[model samples]
Target: MTNYNAVFAATFAAGAGVMGMAQTADAQHAGHNNGMSDFDVYASSEYGFCDAKKIASVWGQSIWEGKMTLANKVRAGLTDLADADIASAEGVRCDWSEAELTYADATQLASYWGNSIEEAKSKVADLMSGMGHKRFVETFADAMADQTEGDEYDVGGNFETYVASSYGYCDAKKIASVWGQSILDGKLTIASKVSAGLTDLADADIASATSVSCDWSEAELSYDDAQRLADFWGNSVEEAKSKVATRMSEIGHKRFVEAFDYVLR
Candidate 1:
């Protein structure tokens, strides 16, 4: 549940399978994105009238909040909150399953676990030092998922960045100039070709600083997926990659941080 790559990639591949060769140029175009997987990842446009830059402002707001959350969590001494939260949340998310649990039920579960939502959330994990790990696991069943405090939220969308090169996909060029500068400055002088390539396009629209939102929305983590992630822990392929971004930051990896560092900066 914590691996960024495994968590999000599994969701993406599961939700939107490979596009395969299309029949027409236009249909091929919608396959791009704005939720469509086009040949480019820089997000040119999709469905004919899509605008990549229009949402720049929104992404910026998201980044601000994300950075603030990370900062606040650190201050609260909940350095591992995101990981635990994401894993527990993912473990019990409501998207892919039909278990009678409404969106309200999800939020309510958070409340039921404790007086304050944060305290209640902390109650979600066994690793959590508080009073409720075993209870949380038993009550939520095997469905709910939450990221470990060990991981941070990662932005795994923007498919163009990862689509294999042989296909000539578009990559986001926005320099992550705002987010994680120190990491980039430490070990790696430049980013990988795929990331570096997107720098120009991501910068073309200097709307707002963008940070990753819930990369793996509750919609993506069904009960079964959450169960699998929790069961695998660090063992399986999908469970581990699910939270790469957070782990990268935790392990303080120079290479992984380089991926999102330039997007906001």
Candidate 2:
């Protein structure tokens, strides 16, 4: 046998290396008058390989001017220029300068916006337009932490809305965690439970029922039992119950929670 798989893999790897070298050569040739080094060309090739067209476009526009470090960072996937700034560079005038963000800021902004460093910076810039650089940095950090710096009611209101929409209390907790709130404490309250559509079940009893197995749909649920079932299914107790209710209702069963009432009987 000719071992076709091994041969194909080797051929693909060689082709990729050749492609990288060719792109580097092209970048060098294009920027010959600008004194681009072999390393710069290699970095540009890597940037292109990463599908960072915007950064590549900006590099080409600047003719490698003041961009060696930024290009290296982009090639390494450590940071990227802002997208809008790159677009501005690609325009006829081509006066867009380098991104003003640090590597950490760029990385965080990229994660927040789920976009290239360039785009994230532009969005962040717009968001922090009126603030000084220090204020912007501090505000960005606070925003990521979900803290409003003592802005009362904003976090709670948002959490309440998230819980009420049947998204589950855990998800609400995650949101609240970002805002530095203890959502568990908030959700444990009677008003919060009712608002989230959760039935009042004793937490201790729910803790005792984890090993018990029965047809959940037909069983009566104490608060404890419901909580255990919710945990088992990776949902909020209210969400688990709501799903059961919806399923039973679909099958023409009215009073859905009552379907589980037989456990008590």
Candidate 3:
């Protein structure tokens, strides 16, 4: 199978298999479910968004108390808690198989396991020792589906975010320039392009950014997009996109630091 098909297969298994497991678990644990397996209960709990909220609240308190920095909390707090929960749930008989994870939880699981779902499942097998591995992988697949359900292959939403975050402002500027050129040549509006989800357009945007040198001065942006970014980043409206891109290029990754960054909170 192609890489994309492999990914699709992994996600499909998680979505379809999770429901089947949930139904089977419910019937099996009908009356005496309370004292059932920890693994099963943990799986079921992931679907309960309220539980995630409670966990977030506790993490907030920890931040307030200076127990951890906001960055640290953002990075590891929830994942750590989830891992702890998984560790505790191991070797215990489960009540239900309805385990569904949040996007963030699934992302962490993927990071821990592997590049692809199959590879990740193998890592889970290492941890699970053949127990609950299939269920965990299925639940993770469910999360993957949730994350990409509507946004798949969309050029504007996740693609834009990915470019900005992964390649920084320099690359973002290049992409915007190339996209603007495409608009001029194809007589396409930004809205139309975004809604179109043309793979060639998306591929071109990525290719232009990755293949070129960073040059904020040469980057193009529509007047509206430039103004919006300018207002958000405290740059003057005159040459707004370039100005914003210049600042981002200069700041680079250090913008995350509390002191060295030029942009205000």
Candidate 4:
């Protein structure tokens, strides 16, 4: 079997600018066990070569960094060991862990995909459906390290935060529009509609929604944000709006119809 302990020891030594020919034979044949019981078993199993390579790269880097606890390194090392495609795509010599060593620098990716980190992670996670939670955390650790510096498990926390942000069945605009139209359609006076729509909403959302609700306003959904929404929903603006409308309460839809008739008067 290939000696992964020696391989990682060399890689770790290289990162620290240390190299000794004698250390090679020593690590390979004579080094004491470092308690990698699972890794040893994994390296000896069928199809362990590629998986061993991936784990060693990450494990070595974690060791060289000398910041993470040993347990954390072992936990981190187990990630991304099964993604043959990701490894192949990266390079003959590179896995996701290796790629991340240089940093994927996901800020640019995030910017290209969406307005926020949460949106970026959502889009990425959708595309990488097979990626596990541990692998995802390890892969995006650099981007998150900067965003949530000073936390021990910032990357994991950021991952959870992004996933949570991606999930709401409704968005601010959908909620506001439904509520606004409902108030407008109510038996209550016109004054009540405006007041209700404007209530508890941020000035920015209200301003934008008002522009959307009032056909006369030149300020529509800005091209960039609209494009982002279209990309995220994978639908045209009209289609997305229609979908949002379907998700509204029946009373909310009825309110929109009543409000439309009132406006026609």
Top candidate (lDDT) = 2
Model 1, 1-84: lDDT tens digits are 222223323433344322211111123234322343332221221100001111212233222123233333433456455334
Regions more than 4 Å wrong, model 3: 1-54, 61-80, 85-157, 161-265
Candidate 2: where are CA atoms >4 Å away? 1-143, 146-152, 160-265
TM-score of 3: 0.19
- Scanning candidate 3 in windows of ten residues, the lowest lDDT window is 62-71
lDDT of 3: 0.34
lDDT at residue 102 of model 4 (Cα atoms): 12
Instruction: Residues 102-216, candidate 2: write the lDDT tens digits.
Output: 3334556678778986677566555443332223444565434432335224334433333233222222223233333333332323224445555333222222323322222
lDDT of 2 at 165: 31
Which tens-of-lDDT digit does each residue in 1-265 have in candidate 4? 1222333333333332111111222233222245433223222222222233333344443111111122233445543333433243232242222112111234445765555644554444443333422355455555444433333243333222212221111222333353442211111122233235542333333333432232100111122323444566789965644443442222232233233333212
Q: Which ten residues in a row have the lowest lDDT in candidate 1?
A: 45-54
Q: Provide the overall lDDT of each model, using Cα atoms, as 2-decimal numbers.
A: 0.28, 0.36, 0.34, 0.31
TM-score of each: 0.20, 0.18, 0.19, 0.21
Which model is ahead, 1 or 2, in terms of lDDT?
2
Whole-structure CA lDDT of model 4: 0.31
Which model is ahead, 1 or 3, in terms of lDDT?
3
lDDT tens digits, residues 1-265, model 3? 0122223223322432222122333333322335432223333332221222233243432111111122133233354554443344444332111121222333456665557644443344443332333334445454444444444453223333232221222333344456533211111222244446553454456454444443232232223444555776677766564564454444321231122223222
